[model samples]
Target: MSPSLTFRPPTTDDAALLLAWRRLPEIAAQSFSDVPDDIDRQRAWIERSNARADYVHRIIQVDGVDVGYGSITVTHAEWRIGTIGVYMGDRRGRTGIGALNFAPMLNHCFHTLGLRKLVNQIFDSNPRVLKGQALLGYRHVGVLKDHALKDGTPRDVHLFEMRAADWAAVRHRFGLFRDMDANVTG
Candidate 1:
């Protein structure tokens, strides 16, 4: 059986943890350029996000232990769309727990948050993430060539989106409800 996972709003005390994960090469490589690495900068970013109405940073816990982080950010106001980003810290990444955690997190974004669409940007070079997102029902939108510079090299990024209707159609295909109930009760 998979370890249980849960998410909660991040608190000020979590600033340090977030900073540590953000600095990890595995996590940082997948993110956009201009991501802050300094502890003070990360702390300030957390404070600012906490105060913003359109942003939420959440801590992902597995069996009561902090293992990673995820966030839902309003990306397009006119479309009522949001983007979700998640990373499984080193420990959990090796255990295949990241995908399990995303199930509930995605449901929360679509059902609880009432988001019309969820967008994810995956680096074209990161085929692992692209495959995972496809398995989760995200449709390929388009690629933004030379969209970001990571490690001082321009890289292409593929945009994927899961609309409300698409989610409703494909969610049950994974038996997500059973997993969701188990997660809630286990």
Candidate 2:
């Protein structure tokens, strides 16, 4: 069976773990913040942001061990759309945790939130993420030229989006949710 994947509301106790992950050189380089260490500020940010009517700040747990972070920000809710942000902070490469975490998040965005569309902003430097998103059916909408600076160099950021109907048709057709569905049957 595919490993169980779940997301829980991040608590203040998770602040340190989040800070450590965020400070990692690889993680920091991809972040817009560009700060090496900001524990105090990070803690405050965590406490201030929690489960709410329109947003969810979650700690990604794979088989119950914290492995990453995720966020769903609802925008134009009345119109049914939101933005999803996720990262595998603990980089155990090729683990397939991304697919596990992603399937549910994408499902949640469309089914639970009743969102018609979803969008993600990613750094061009992070081609791996971009490629994965594309494979999972996100379309390149556009790019903002020199929108973000990384390591003192200008980097382009790209925008990607997916519609709920499009995703539903592919959820199983393209094997996006095949593994998860297998678990359900077997």
Candidate 3:
């Protein structure tokens, strides 16, 4: 299905919710950077994000209720490539809900923003995300074995990536094909 949730860039008013979401135990465990407890520090992060053209931090809202965060870091503007990251802080459900959130974000990247390739690395500990990524048409490109630490324990990182073409080939199966076609042809 197409997205029913709203995807918008973060604002100063979101500092508190952002702080709390990052502090969620599951989110913190997998994050590459630490989430400081201070609200000012969180706002400082939003400021930094605003300053970078390649960085985007979005607050995911469903019917005006904040539920998660999604971000993409453009590693190569010339190549139309980037990296994706997301985490749900306040909601829990069956595996497929990720599609509801991911389809729109990716549609924005691939069609609206003109990104060609998107890549992301998932901690092996988070198998659920891996499954979601696979279902979304991302392919396993490589792995960094024991390359990162979580609570002093090393965890392997699995890399997944998709080109615009890759997404097109599978979009129909996931209900993301129609909007893309309409945007391109109409």
Candidate number with greatest lDDT = 3
Could you tell me every candidate's TM-score relative to the true structure?
Answer: 0.86, 0.83, 0.87
> How accurate locally, in lDDT, is each candidate?
0.76, 0.74, 0.78
**Is candidate 1 or 3 superior in TM-score?**
3
For model 3, residues 47-157, the per-residue Cα lDDT tens digits are 989789897667776656677888878999999999888888867412335576777667767876679999898998888888889888899988999989877888899
Ranked candidates, highest lDDT first: 3, 1, 2
Which stretches of candidate 2 lie above 4 Å from their native place?
173-186
Model 3: worst 10 consecutive residues (lDDT sum) = 177-186
Residue 107 Cα positional deviation in candidate 2, in Å, after optimal superposition: 1.2
Error of 1 at 7 (Å): 1.0
The weakest ten consecutive residues by lDDT in model 2 span: 177-186
Residue 44, candidate 3: Cα error in Å is: 1.2
In candidate 3, which residue pairs get closer than 3 Å at backbone N, Cα or C atoms, i.e. clash?
none
lDDT (Cα, tens digit) per residue for candidate 1, span 103-126: 776676667666789888899877
- What are the per-residue Cα lDDT tens digits for candidate 2 across 48-157? 67636788667777777778887778977888889987777776423866555677677767776678999888988888888988878889999999998877888899
Error of 3 at 29 (Å): 1.1
lDDT of model 2 at position 86: 75
lDDT comparison, 1 vs 3, better candidate: 3
